[model samples]
Structure formats: structure tokens, C-alpha cells
Target: MSTTQTQMRREIEEIPTAVDRLLSTSAGAIETAISKIGNDVPFLMSVARGSSDHACAFLKYACELELGLPMASVGPSVASIYGAKLRVPNAVCISVSQSGKSPDIVELTRAITEGGATSVAITNDATSPLANTATATLPICAGPELSVAATKTFVTSLVAGLWLLAEFKQDQELVKAIRALPEHLEKAIACDWTVAANAITGQSVLTLGRGPSFAISNEAALKFKETCQIHAESYSSAEVMHGPVSIVERGFPVIGFAASDAAEDSLIEVADALTEKGALAFVTSKKAKKAICLPHQRTDHWLTDPISTIVSFYTMVEKVSTARNINPDAPRHLNKVTETV
Candidate 1:
């Protein structure tokens, strides 16, 4: 599959299959390209723009939880926009780009390397400008994605991110768990979006969480806005309380990821808080969303929830779009490969 492929049919597929690809590729390179950076870097960081940026957010969260490595995403314009600088002298900069040629990302990679950090490009093109500068590269097998709204590539990137974390940490339990993704993906394809549609179809939706869960909410909101053309946004439960409180109103579909774990109490509190404000909350557990749940994803380690949840919502969006007879293969205002800086 080339980078421009998008399938229109409604079909069920297991997420584990994608995770398996991630684990195999990352682990297979553990002794070589993938893990070699440990020699020069004591920490990890990532940079991207748009969907690729979101992927790096997930990567930062996963690497922190799985490997205890401190990480950050250098905003695309940190150097260009604010003249702010990345100070890591021995860090790994993982740049994610579908085309591997975004000028901003390439510039950022150059900045990181000049600062004495090693960079690994996780992209769809090995020869892209971004890849051309990478010390190493990890290409996703999502084929050619044709839709302007990203789907498979986003989900695949999440898989690859976690798989890479497993490689650096050599967390066999987590690797074994990722191996089950294909099966989970198969089951995820079977998810029904009727309820999600009913709640969000014509309304503005707000997804709220904290830490990694907050990132998941961001991705969920992004998918909703992209595929369904709806108004959706995310808030950290904490941040929302600070100022976003005024926007809370009746009839808003506020999806709260109240998974069981360290953030469970706070997440549930946020759900309660939302319910108190007259919003609806749909919570899924690792076991509740079993097919896509990876290992070591206990309540304390709920960062993995988004990995499964993205696969879940991506399937639902496809379902809802098709039910509305909206061709998910192509949305109204987008194309297969974007050429943004």
C-alpha cells in the first residue's frame, strides 16, 4: 500500500495486528538502529506539526510511563515562533511526519542534532527530507492514506510509539501485550457508534482528562472535528476548572476517560463533576475495551488507554460516517498527503 491508500468499505479489523508490526520492527532493531541511541542520549523528546504532533504527544506520555524517561515535545515553532530553544545536549529527538518532509520538522531535527542529540525519524517515507537527516528511521506500514483527515496512520503511529518504548525498556510483559493488538483491532472494528452519534452528531463535544488521558481526549476531539465536521475540543480536568468552567452547559457530550488506575480517582471525580454540570460521560475500562487493551495497562498506567481508545474511536468514526453515507475514504476539504510546513 502506497501512502495514498484509503479503503471505503466497512470492515472489522483487530488492532493487535498493527501493534504486532510495531513490536516486531522496533524490537528487531533493539540491538541495532532502534536502541543504539541510548549510547548518546539519556532522555527522549519529539517534534511534529498537526497529526504528527499529536503522535509525539502520545510518544512522550508512553516513554515516560513505560521507561521512566523524561520527555517533551519541542513545539514546531519553538525555534521559529518564539525563538525558544531546545536545550537537550544528549537527547533523542523522534520526529513524526507522514511524508517525512515537513520543513518545520526538518528544521527542528536540524536544531536537535546541532544541540548534540540523536534523532530518529518515524515517518512513512525513508527518503523524505526529515528522514534524510535522521540518524535512523522508523517507517509506518499504514500504506498510502488518501483522506485529508488522518485515520490509520495516526493509530499506527501510536502503536509504533508504544512498541518503541518497549524496546528501550525491554519490557517483555508490555511487548507481549502489544502482540495482542491485531485481535483487539479486529474486535474494535465491531464497535457500534450509534450512541456516540446520538450524543455528538449535531452538538459540540468536549473530551476532558489529565496527563496521557488528556492527550487521548485531544486525539478524540481531533478525529471528531476532522471526520464528522463537528465542534469538539479537549481540556485537562484541572485546566477546565480554572477557566473553561463557564462554557459547560446542558446537552454537551463530555467524554471522560475514567479508566481504573492512578488517575482513576481524579478522572472519576471529573466525570462526577461533569455530571454535576449536566454532561454525559461514557467511560471504558481496559477490560471493558478488552480487544484493544495492551498489557501493564493497570489503573496506575492508564496512558495505554489511548492506544486502544484511538483504535476504538477511529472504528466508530468510520461506522458513523458510513451510516450517514459520508464517504470516510474522502472528506469534503482534504487530500491523501498534506504538504504543510
Candidate 2:
């Protein structure tokens, strides 16, 4: 095996610094974005595709649980392709894009802003079209990422969006946790997921999560496919028991992402159930009965703990890619920026 570190690994290791940079440099921008939302905002709208969309999903849960506002994702094609007009005068739209250059995202953000919604662009490039189109721009400050599989950018985007929500709600506890994330994420990057890495022996795998962790699960599934050429599927713990369990077989790999939240016990239960069915199940929580517990990093707050899990996941997936003799820095057909319209 080659001892050379891939760009993906370097980017994954830089996640903590990226988040720290975002928190330190983007505070003023985050505050400015919050001011634009105003107090009487009715709801929230999200716009993005791929990993950026997963970040929006994570923010969707945060907005509902923290701000008590409903967040729905508005498809970019509605404006880019169909030329449909949106009327969200009282809503606040958050568009997440690492490059902030996607034509579809830029077009939809423009439409929503023209329709009377206050638009906020969360991106690394403040000069990109999406940032120029939105009412406010909160740059992620993840620096330049050369890897096709995003690591630092994704984590920074999560921090940027969560920080915006935390500041908007003025929740000091969550804000403190956000501020302390750099160190926690440093530990998260060192978490040993060797068991999970060894579990990927076949072409297919299953991942489970609930609540905010489900968004991380979605990102994990995407990474497995893009980086390791594995057919991975993610499901909510509640939904997996219904029909997805039919595919579980003996010695099958199942990874469950459970943060220290209300849904942790329920998610672990599903991991244990899958373990009982003879699958090699691994969960992040220690309360699992039959499932194996992977070493995980937990933050001071439940909301931020799931974000740490994704950092650990990035490390493990990078190793999986190298062990399979694939170059994670460059996936077969992916680019650094996808400007879809």
C-alpha cells in the first residue's frame, strides 16, 4: 500500500481548522445574516444539491427544533427549468453551496428573493453568483479544497449554517458548543473506526440514523459510493425496521450513527436488532446490547455531537478508499464544483 497521504485525507484532517476559521472569521457575517431575517419571519426554505443539500437537511432539523420554524427545501429546477414563480414573502431562504456558482442555485435564490423572501447564501465563495444573488452571504471559510470528495467544506458549511441558526435564536448554550467545536472536532478526527472500516468487505452496506444524525447518515452513504465504490444506503431508524430490514443478512455490514440525543436509544435498538439478525452492526453509542460500539466523540451539546460523527466518518471512509486501491482525491466522474442548471 502507498504511504503517501491523499488530498482527501489532508482535507479531512483540516476539518477542525476549517471550522475554526469559519467561526472566527465569519462571526460578523453570521450576525449580518441574522439581522436580515428579522423577527417576524414565517418559515424557512432550503436550496442546494448533493452534500450541500445534506448540510441544509441538518439545518432543517436545527431550525425546527431550536427556532420552532418549519424548513422546506425548494427545488432549484422550479425556477431554472420550469420558470415557476415563488411567493414566500414572510419566509427566509438559506441556500448552501460550497462553490456558490451553481446556475440552478443562483437562479432559484434570485427568484425567491424577488418573490419577497429574505435570502441567505452559505458558501465558501462570497464572490460567486449565488452569493451575489442572495440578500446576505455567510462565507464558510473552509479555504481551498482540492479533493473531489468534500471534507473540510462540508464540515465548515455545517458549522456556518448551525452557527447562523444558533445566533438567530440567541441560544447561548448551543453557541458555546459551536465555539468549542474546533477542539471537539479535533478529537473526532482521531476516533478509531477500524471495526467499521474492516466491515466493508462486500459491495453493499447499510447505515442508520435518526433526527439530525440522519443527515450525516445520508452524507455517509454518498461518500461510500463516491469514494469507495460501495453501494451504501441510509435510512431512519424507525423507517428501516419497516421494509429495509428485509435486506439484512448474516455478516452484513450495518453502521448506526447515534448521537447523545432523545433518539439515541431508539437508534441503538435498531442496531442491536440488526445484530441479532447476524449482521455485523456497529453503533456510536455505548448502550448497545448486541451491536458493537465504535469509538465516537461527543460534544457538550447533543445537536453538535452528530456533526462530530461525520468527521470520524470521513477518516474511516478515506482509509476504506485507500485499502481498496482507489484514489479518493479524484473520483471517477466528479468535479470540484458542479454548476448544474
Candidate 3:
């Protein structure tokens, strides 16, 4: 590996500082959104795509696990294409867009807001249309992300969304964890995932996780595709054994993302089980008996653990891209801002 770094690597390294910036600067916006939400919400909805969508998925787990409130992702096309006005009265809708320029996201957010949901837009661009259309806007504060494959923006988005949820629930524990993430993420960035990277020499790989970490698995798979040009699939550990395990062959690369949560043991068992099937499986948890255990930085809380895991994965993915001689900064056929209609 060259001593030089790519834009993706720089962004990956910036995640810790970006999160610290967000926690310091975004408090007012988050407080305003929480005030609008006001605790009696029956359920929550999310609007996003790509990495932002995966961030929302992680927040969905956070919302459900932390606040005991159900959350779902509302397809932007519902309002953008079909122009359907769905009933979401007295609900909270969170729309995440790093660029905040996508027409579908803006249109759907506007429609959802008009449909009686207290909408909050999380974006890097505080002045964009989605920001203006939503009830409140929370800038991710990740600064300028030059890489086409999002790194800092994704981490900051996850932090922004989780921070909002934590404040809304008045969960001081989670809030403390959120505030402590910058330090933990610094450690996460230092974690060497070269073993997992080297195992990913094949065209296809499987990523497994459960609950919140499943969202990280999804984002990791997307990053592999975008940065390394590899075919990666993410599956919930519970769902993988149903049929997806049929594809596991000798030396198949499998990575399981496990956090210090209720789902950790089960995910570890699944990772080890895959190893029994002749797959070269790796997991983050040290409890893994058969699967290779990768060094991972655990955060102050379970919810924050997955966030750290992604930072480590980002570093590893950058190494994988470097090994393949692929320019992760400008992925083929991709642009910084994807304006969807």
C-alpha cells in the first residue's frame, strides 16, 4: 500500500472531528426539531436514499430500541412520482439528504409535511430546498465531502439522526455516548481490518448484522460496491440462515458486524456457523469461537458501537480500493450530487 491517501481516506479520518463539530454546532437545530416533535408522536417515518437511507435505517433501530417508538422509511417516490397523499397525522418525518438537492426527497418531504407530519430535514446543505421545505433542518456538519463515495457525510448523518432521537427521548445515557463518539471513532479509524480486506479478493462477499448493526452491514456492502467495485450483499443474521447460506462455498468471504447489544451473541454464532460451512468468516465480537475476530473499538453505548464499526470499515474499504488500484474518490458513473426526480 502506498503511503499516500485518497479523498475517501481523508474523509474517513475526518469522521471523528466531523462528529465533534456536529455535536458542538447542531445542538440548536436538534433542539428545535425535538421541540416540534414533542414526545407524543405515534410513530416515525424516514426519507432518504443511498448512504443516507442506511443512516435512517440505523436510526430506525435506535428509535425503536431507545424510545420504544416504531419507525419506517417512507419511499420518496410515493409523493414524487405517484403524488399520493398518505395519512401520517401527528407523526415525525425525518428526511436525510447530504446534498439536499434531490427533487424526490424535497418533494416528498414537502408532501409529508403538508400531510401533518412534523418533518425534520438532515442535510449538509442547510440552505437547500429540502432544508427550507421541512419543519426544521439539522445540518450534518460533516464539512465538504469531496469523495463521490460518502464517508464523513454518512457518519455525520448518523450522528445527527441519533443525536436528535436521543435528545427527544431525553436519554442522557445515549446522549453521553453520542458526545463520546469522537474519541471512540478515532480509535475505530486506527483499527486494522487488513485481514478482512485481504479475504475480499473474490468478486462477491456477504456482510451480516442484526438490529442496528444490520444497518451498518447494509452501508458497508454499499461502500464495497461504490469504492472497491465489488459485489457485496448484506443480510440480517436472522434472515441469512433461511436461504442465503446456500451460496456459502469454500473460502467465501463473510463479514459479520456485531455490537455490544442483545443481538451480539446471535450474530457471533451465525458468523461462526458460516465458518463451519467452509467460508472465511470474520466478526467484530471477540466472543467468536470459529470466525476470525477483527479488532473493533467499542463505544460507551451499544447504539454508538456500530457507528465506530463503520469508521473502521471505511478505512478497510479504502485499503481494498487501494489494493485494487481503483480511485475511490471518483467512482465510475457516479457524481457527487445525484439529483433524482
User: Candidate 3 lDDT, tens digit per residue, 40-132?
Assistant: 799999999999999999999999998899999999899999999878899999999999999999999999989989999999999999999
TM-score, per-candidate, Cα-based: 0.83, 0.99, 0.98
Q: Give stretches of model 3 more than 4 Å off.
A: 1-3
Give one digit per residue, the lDDT tens place, for model 2 in 1-341. Answer: 68899999998888998888888888899888888887899999999999999999999999999999999999999999999999999799999999999999999999999999999999889999899999999999999999999888888888898999998988999999999999999999999999889989999999889999999999999999999999999999999989989998999999999999999999998899999988999999999999999999999999999899999999999999999999999889888888898
Give each model's whole-structure lDDT.
0.66, 0.93, 0.94
RMSD of each: 5.0, 0.7, 0.9
Q: 2 or 3: which has the higher TM-score?
A: 2
Highest-TM-score candidate: 2
lDDT of 1 by residue, 47-161 (tens): 8877777888878877887777888777767654555556677688888887886677887787787787878888867678987887777776666655566666777777676
lDDT for model 1, please: 0.66
**Poorest 10 consecutive residues of model 2 by lDDT?**
30-39
> Clash number for model 3?
0
